[model samples]
Structures are given as structure tokens and as C-alpha cells.
Target: MTQQPHLFCFGLGYTALALARVLKQQGWRVTGTCRSTSNTEEARALGLEIVIFDPDHPVEGLAQRLAGVTHLLSSVPPGAAGDPVLQAHGATLAEAAPRLKWIGYLSTTGVYGDRQGGWVDEQSPLTPSGERGQRRLDAETAWLALPQPAHLFRLAGIYGPGRSVLDTIRAGKARRVLKPGQVFSRIHRDDIVQILLASFAHPNPGAAYNACDDDAADPAEVTAYACKLLNVAPPPEVPFAEAALSPMARSFYDDNKRVRNDRIKRELGVTLKYPDYRAGLTALLATESATSSSTTA
Candidate 1:
């Protein structure tokens, strides 16, 4: 009897949840770790197997849980002490590397740091500007060092479904922050899932791919587009310097670059479903409206 495909994700966050849901629908056994009991319950409600895990709270018997897991994906970000998964289960993973077909580590475009609106691809020098970016870069190195070849996905800003700017606007917190010569690369969550699925089809270990859309536009442009889709007036624009953004939110402005995703297309044979903010926001609005109609019916 042929063995079924089984995917084990290190962290069942937004992106991982999306990928796991798709794989589960296609008959793959999916299991992963969340950070909290509430998230575990919510994920289980969606027919996913999730256990709580973190740096201090490691999952017991992770090795036994991961038995027969053909594919592995880690979306956990490194903390001050480093990657929680590796810190806790590196030995087990190294021991199991021989049987695992593929391992993917979800990194960030922040590893590329600020580029002054310049473009960067997979070959770009990693010069992360902050402590968070540095942590991600370090974690990528650790994952690649494992005996099992690991694929690194440097993802740009992710938004989709209930997580996009549409939610921000509806919640009355949308803002158009203008920064001269500043641009950000963003990928819709669905596009990220497609890239992951494509990579699974074309398994190339020791490969690093930039996961983002072809369009790199300003935040203000994306916000304006989302407002247009919602049929609401765009909020007054605020200069980046005076936006009064929280320290964490303000940190996002430290990077300015157009991330090139040609590698995923050229090597993995992948195409983006929503190539730009306009298309993504439009589709999100349509989906939300359809869901609302169904609920009302």
C-alpha cells in the first residue's frame, strides 16, 4: 500500500493555516502547533490538528507526533533566544531528516533590509536593518544547516481574507501614510499558498525563493484602492513622519524596496492569482460581500 502524504507545520499561523486547509481538503494528513489554547480550539474547529507550542512551552513527544510526516514547514519566527522549534527539537529533526522528503522555512523579505526603493531577488545581499530581521536571518541559517535540505521562502507583507486592509477600513482605523520614494512588496495569502503548493510539486531543496507579487506599490496606494473597493472615501493622507504609528507599526517603514519574485515563476512554474493590490482588494471585497449575502440568507 502506498503511503499517504502528511504535512507537519511548525506553526499554524495565518499562512500555514491557509496551506494546511488546502492540503487537508486534498486528502493530506495535516498537523501543526499553535501558541495558545484558544487558537488550538479554533484550528480544531476547522478540522485541523493543532497543539500549543512556544519557546518556553515545547510540545512533548514532538518526534513521535512527526512520525511518517513526509513534508515539514516552519513558519515560526525566532525569538530573543532563537527559533523555539529548533531549540527544542533540533535533535529529533536531524534524526528524522533521512525520511523527510522536503522541509520549508518561511522567512521574511525583511532579511533583505532597506533597499532605498531598489529591487532585490534571491541573490540580494542580506542586510537586515532590525533585530527582528536579524533573528529571521539567523533562523534561516539554522534550518538550512539541517541534514534534510530546506527550502527558504522570503515572503513579503501578507494580507488576505479577514486580514487585509478592508478589515482595517471597516474597523475605522485605515490610514494613508505618504512616504516619498517608499514602496512595499505584498502578497495575497492565496498567492502565498499557491507558491507553497507549487514548490511541493517541484521539490528543489537548498533553494531560496522570493514570494511576492509583481507590483510594489506605496501603502497609501493600497489603502486608497481598498477604500475604493469598499465604496468609502479614502482617509486623509498623513506623512510618514507624522503618522503617529506605534513603534511596531512604525518599524515597517524602515524598509523600502521592490522585491522581485521571478525565481518562483521561473523555477517553480508558479503564477500569482492576485498580481497587485488593486486586484487583491477587489477580490477580497467580492468575497466578503458574497459571505455576507450567504449569512443573511
Candidate 2:
């Protein structure tokens, strides 16, 4: 008898929930771990069986949970203690890994560090400017060293649905920050799922891929475009030097690089649903319109 597809996500964040939704529709069994009981409630609303799992504080029954898991994906970020998933439950996963088809670790393009606004592929050097990026690099290494097939998806700025510049604009927090020659790569959340789904069909273990849209664009342009979509005037551009951002926020601007998504295309054959910010924002605005009308009606 052929085994059924089962996905066990370590952290059921926004992205994981989206993937679970599609997999459930495709007749796959899905289960996941969330940080808190409150998030577990939200996961249940998505029709997923979720357990309270805070890797920082250890939990039991992880071994039992791994029993029937055929595939695994971890979206959990690393911390000072390193990867919470590996530190807490690496042994159980290693035991279950041989039979598993694929394991994907959602890493950050920050792992590539500051590339002087240049371009980086999957094989770029891992020299992160901050401790957070270093931790992710460590986590990626640990996951890949596992005896199972593991794929690393180094993702750029992720935006979609309620988390895009559109939301920021509507919430009265939008800023047109201008730093000349500073371009950042962003990927739509839906496109991220599609890339993963495509990889699932191909199943290349020990492979690393960069996940980002074709357009590596200026933030000011994105801000102006969002305002255009909403029929609002764009905010005045604030030069990056005068923005007075927090250290964490400033750290983001330290790294500048355009990511190449050719591997996902050449290897997994993915054609991004939103190839650029313009396409993504237009589609999201349309969805917002339809959803608002339906809810009001």
C-alpha cells in the first residue's frame, strides 16, 4: 500500500497555515506545532490538529507526533539558544527522518549578509551582519546535517494579503523611505507556497533555493505604488538618514542585495504567480475589494 502525504510543520505561522490549507484540500493529513495555546486555537480554526509547542520550554509527546509524519517543514526562527526545534526534538526527528520524503527549512536571505546591493544566488557567502542572521545560518547547518533529505529555502522580504505595504498605508504608518540604490527583494506569500509545492513535486533533497520575485525594487517605489492602488497620494520621501529608525529596523537596511530565483524555475519549474510588486499589489487589492463586498453584502 502506498503511504499518504503527511505534513508536520514545526511552527504554524502565517505561511504554514496557508500551506496547510492547500494540502488539506489536496487530501493530505496535516498537523503542526504552535508557540502558545492561543495560537493553537487559531490553528484549530484552520482545521489542523496542533499541539502547544514552545521549544524554548520543552514539551513531551514530540516522539509520538513524529510517528506518521512523511514530510516536515520548519518556519521557526533561531535564537540565542540556537534552533529550538533541533535543540528540543532533533533526536526524535532524526529517528523519523530516514523514511521521510522531504524536509524544508525556511531560512532568510539575510543569511547572505550585506552584498553591497549586488546580486546573490543560492551559493552566496553566508556572512550575516547581525546576530539574528548568524543564528539562522547555524540553524540551517544543523537541519541540513540531519541524516534526512533537507532543502533550504532562503526567503527575502515576505508580503501578502494583510501584511503588505497596503496594510501599512491604510494603518497610517506608511513611509516612503528613500535610500538611493537600495533595492530589496520581496516575495508574495502565495508564491512562497507555490514554490514549496513545486519543490514537493520534484523532491530534490539537500538542495538550496532562493525564494524571491523577479523585481528587486526600491521601497519608495513600492510605497508610491501602494498609494496609487488605494487612490491616495503618496507620502513624501524621507531620506534613509533622517528616518530615525530603531536599531533593529536600521539593521535591515544594512544589507542590500537582489536575490536570484532561477533555481526554483530551473529545478522545480515554478512560474511565480506574482512576478513583481505591481502584479502582487494589484491582485491583493482586487481580493480586498471582493472580500469587503462579500462581507458587507
Candidate 3:
């Protein structure tokens, strides 16, 4: 009899849980960790096998729990103290390296920081503009240093489903900040899942792939498009300098790079379902309409 595939996730957040659910439906055993008690309960409610894990509270008997895990994914971001998962369980992972078929580390395109509206592919040198990006770069280095072939996915701005410009408009919080020549790369959440699935099938260890759509568009343009889709008047354009954005939101504008995702297509033989924002947004709107109609029926 063939051995059953098992996947262990370090942080079962939005994207990780999305992947976990798909694999579970396909007969893969999925187990993972969540930091808080509420999240633990919620994941359990979703039929997930979850455990509490954080810097202060590490999972007991983690090595044993990971015994049959054929695949590993870490979606946890590195903080000032570095990667919480790596800090807590690096040794256990190294010891179990041989048995793990594939290991994936979720990184960010922020690692290529401040590209000045230039383009960057997977091979571009990592020069993060901010502390957050640097921390992720450090975590990527540590993960790649492991004996196992760790695949690194450098993702761009992730938006989909309940979290997109469409939702922003409905909440009456839409803003179109005017910053000319500044563009961002983004991927739908489902597309991100698809990339991960494709990588699982291809399994090229030690490779870094850029996970983004074909479009590198201005934020204002995206906002306008969303408004059009909803038939709402576009919000007044606020000059980027005059916009009262929180520090965290302001930080995102620091990077101006268009990421290239050719490697994923060339190597993984994967075609993105939504190749750009237009396609992604249209599909999202259609889905939302269908859901609302079905609920009312």
C-alpha cells in the first residue's frame, strides 16, 4: 500500500489554511499550529487538526507530531526576533529533514525592496527597504540553509474573496492615492494557492519563485476599476503626500517594483487563472453576485 501524504503547516493563517483545506479534501492529512486560543478553536471548527504555538508557548512533542509529515509549509512572518517557528523548532526540522519530501517557505517580494518602479525576477538581489522585508530575507536565508531542498515563494500583495478592493468600496473606506509612476504587483489568494499546488507537483527544491499576476498596476487605477465594477463614484483622489495614511500603510509605498513571475510558468508549467487585476476583479464580482443571489433564494 502507498504511504498517505501528510502536510504540516507552521502557521495556518489565511493562505495556509486555504491550501490545507484543498489538500484535506484530496485525502492529505493536514495538521498545523495557530498562535492564539480563539484561532485554535476556529480552525478546529473548520475540521482542522490544530495546536497552539508561539514564542512563549511551543507545541509539546512537535517532533513526534511531525513524524509522518511528507510536506512542510511555513507561512509565519519573521519579526524583530526573527522567525518564531525557526527559533523554536529548527533543530527538530533539521533532524527530520531526510524524511520530508518538500518544504516551502512563504516569503515576500518586499525582499526586493524599492525597485524604483523597476522589474525584478527571482534571481534579483534581495535588498529590502524596510525592517519587515529584511526580517523576511533573514528568515529565507535560514530556511534555505537547511539540508532539505526548501522552496521559497516570494509573494506580492495578496488580495481575494473577503479581502479585496471590492470589499474596501462596500465598507466606504476606498481611497485612490495619487502617486504617479508607482505600481504594485498583486496575486489573488486563489492564485497563490494554485502556485503552491503547482510547486507541490513539480517539487524543485532550493528554488525561489515570484508569485504575482501579469499586471503591475497603479493603486489608483485598481481603485477606479473596483469603483466601476460596483457602479460607485470613485473617491476623490488624494495626493500621495497629503493622504493621512497610517505608518504601516505608508510603508507599502516605499517599494516600487514590478515583479516577474515567468519562472513559475516556465518551470512549474502553471498558468494563472487570473492573469491580471481586471480578470481577478471581474471573477470576484461575479462570484459575489452569485453568492448573494443564492443566499436570497
41-99, model 3: which lDDT tens digit per residue?
65676677888898889888989998888999999999899999889999999888778
The runs of at least 3 residues in candidate 3 whose Cα sits more than 4 Å from the true structure, single-residue gaps closed, are none
Please state the error at residue 106 of candidate 1 in Å. 0.7
Q: For every model in order, what is the number of clashing pairs?
A: 0, 0, 0
lDDT of 2 by residue, 123-238 (tens): 87889988999999999999998898589999999999899999999999999888899999999999999999998898888899999999999999999999999999998889
Question: Among these predicted structures, which one has the highest lDDT?
Answer: 3
Q: Give lDDT per model, in order.
A: 0.91, 0.90, 0.92
lDDT of 1: 0.91
What lDDT is reached at residue 248 by model 3?
100
Stretches > 4 Å off in candidate 1: none
TM-score of 2: 0.97
Tens-place lDDT digits, model 1, residues 1-297: 988999989999999988988988899998889888877765786687787788888888888988889999999999999988899999999888778888999999999999999999999999999999999999999999899768999999999999999999999999999999889999999999999999999998889999999899999988888888888999999998888999999999999999999999999998789998888888988888899999999
lDDT of 2 at 252: 89
Among residues 3 or more apart in sequence or in different chains, the pairs in candidate 2 whose N, CA or C atoms overlap within 3 Å are none
Worst 10 residues of 1 by lDDT: 37-46
